[model samples]
Target: MAFVPAPGYDPAYDPPVPYITAIPGGLRPGMLFYIRGTLAKGYTRFRVDYATGQYEGSDIALHFNPRFDGRDRVIFNTFQNGAWGEEEKKKDTPFSSSRPFELVVQITQANYQITVDGKPYHEYSHHIPMDRVTWLNVKGDIVLQAASIIGCGVGSAGSKGGAVGIPGGLPPMVGPVCNRPAIPFTANIPGGMIPKRTLVVAGHISSGAKSFIINLKKYSSNDIPLHINSRMIKNVLIRNTFLNGVWGEEEKDIQNNPLQKGQFFDLSIRSGDQNFKVYVNGHCLFRFDNRIKNVQEIDTVEIQGDAELAYVFF
Candidate 1:
């Protein structure tokens, strides 16, 4: 059966297999779909399809299939009028049985940019009109955890005129809702960090927790360009950079501490030309100056400590 679209951010957490839902606002440029799940043990194959409907023979705009039968590989194709189109295959597959995985599909004007974990994997050109796609179907040997459609900004999910800003002229881009992720979770920032790019981390702090760390690190390096350490016991939010094996002077000067034990919090960090603007629960928390001049190199995000992640979106 087709699921109804949800406004703003729509998410399904720990959904059953053969899951199908209507795409919120339909497909459009700059929107994205995030799926996180684990492959069952000894799994051979699984598929995710963007289709026109929820029926068994619905026309699939994009079929993403990963096969582990012999040599691990992924195949991309389309189905129209009960006929499968030419297949595009990639020999390497990033998914493994019994291992958790994160996948993001970004809708663009010409193609679908697929990212696995935190790296760009493939780009599949559009064979069917993206607007013709309305439902998302996932089936096969996988334990579906969380799936969400994001990047529509503050407007309603059915809005077609693009993201609309709030009354005060704030930016339109907003983070998607994510479910619980494994602790010590790390993912790559697609296209790397750049000005105007926003990262949202939402979760609940464990009761009687000590602290949690959120780091924006350089890919394949130990340098942490941005590190957020929230010490809940002390009520201090420490912001610092770790470069050359040394921690820079800590910036612990926030007027209020928004984090509380066993409470949910939404944290957003937006990159600027010279600083990172941080907001907590929709209020400006603090700003940290860019210590790493080359911001694009800071591509990995690491989160660990006493919290259950609701979602992480970049």
Candidate 2:
């Protein structure tokens, strides 16, 4: 499954070196993290850690260290109570200095699966409880470009016919996985909207685009619980609801518009108990309070207007 940056956790772009931040909601079995950076020329080593706390000397659940001193190797270990656990080493390194690289780390029940530049790299078994890992620390000689965390569904390693431990307690109803889906697309949100359920829409805006609309509607009625209209020409985003053949007041206030003409975007809408949180390109854009109390009735998603879609996942 293609993963967009998870809503509620902002993606870091061009972040400073030695970045340390809390992993919002912590590490769950289905969570995936993506990191992209360029190794500094003539670099010696660099490391990324999933830690229990942000402070130095805090226990580290997983330590991923790539070394380039005399022998190029990657070391994996755990740190607890001022001691390092036995090290697991991979002899070959998939990274090179002065080159850009993409690394993906996926959390599973048994191990951390690592991928480098789209290839399976290594898997390190858990030495510390994953739930205790609440922080991510990246340091050493690399220029970090981007880092994001996203949900890719539960039991991602293939468990059949069982309830997932996610908040909604339902198997992910991720759909069609369309590639470049035709404009004016619509899809069903099976089992209806519930708190902690997330919808992801990824695509590129048409160069001459003027506007686009995303609507969450009831499958059997004309009522729309949420309608998002983005007007590129006016640089405004409008949010409203339609009920009883009438539209509610429009919400136009936002921090800043993140949409632009001819640019790719990953838009996420995460349902919460009281409101819907909207994020674009990994940044929270705004929140819309629930106008319709019964969200389970909002079962259909419709998209239209001047944009080229990559995919829509619910």
Candidate 3:
């Protein structure tokens, strides 16, 4: 589900765009947050970012992409690079710019409940937890003016700590998973199997770095692939797939890996789960222990230098 914009929604003329805001790197499980804003004209994409001061980083987490009809409905689609497609608000669609609208959502250990303008709309359940999100963004020129967060009060008078397995007192998880502005890959990861490079399916295929990487998920394991990302998938496994180079040869390393200057890479998946845990050079870097669980299995791994992709195993 994609959206253009209302015919002429203006941010400056309308009330200041309410901020779709959240704390970065501190999302815990079981919390509620309020995201209120005006659907002023000219708003197209809505995204959430977690890495402060830096737009694109491997450390960033969660992004939500939504579309509006510019009439009477606003839709919040699910997943970044995986399936589950789009889900629309049931009660009060806020696609029209005629009046102001607000959306409030509660995240529990088991599911998510949404309320638009004080009325309940929909609830989604997940096996993984949603409490792991830290940053949020809204894109497509839409302006959000104000925002607030509410904590789940299960263990204390107003305790906002995440669930049992994770640490305590982390920020509420409202990270967005779609509508993110595209950032380019900064490192020249050797394509295909190159010499002196270890091959791994995740370093190339899991990062959403390019159109080719996106298409890699569709390649099948039975000499062809289908899907990847960490979610509720069990039983099936993917291993040792080879990178096909520009010459169709298993790629080999030659030059020092260098990306186009001013280019940066982003790590995100189509699944709503925030737990696409990543590591660099055998060191654990980012772990999205939140609820957005959609895992992928990769085969035929490849790499350029000293790096280990054991975490991609899920």
TM-score of each: 0.56, 0.56, 0.34
Candidate 1 on 1-314: residue-level lDDT in tens? 12222234455657788788777556888777878788976688999999988798989989999999888899999999999999999999999774577788988899999988767899998888877887889988898767767765355333223333342333344433343568989888876777756677767688988998899998777799899998988889899999989999999987887776766566777776699888765567888999877787888899988987756776
In model 3, where do residues sit more than 4 Å from their true spots?
Answer: 1-30, 44-66, 69-74, 80-92, 152-314
Regions of candidate 1 where Cα sits further than 4 Å from its true position: 1-6, 152-210, 213-314
lDDT sort, best first? 1, 2, 3
Q: Could you give candidate 3's per-residue lDDT for residues 158-235 as a string of tens digits?
A: 112232222222212122211111222112222311211121122212332222221222123322121122211221
Q: How much is 44 displaced in model 2, in angstroms?
A: 2.3
Pick out the ten consecutive residues of candidate 1 with the lowest summed lDDT.
1-10
Model 2 lDDT, residue 251, Cα: 98
Q: What is the C-alpha lDDT of each candidate?
A: 0.77, 0.77, 0.32
Cα lDDT of model 2 by residue, 58-150, tens digit: 999999999998988999999999999999999999997745677878788999999886678999988888768878899998888677555
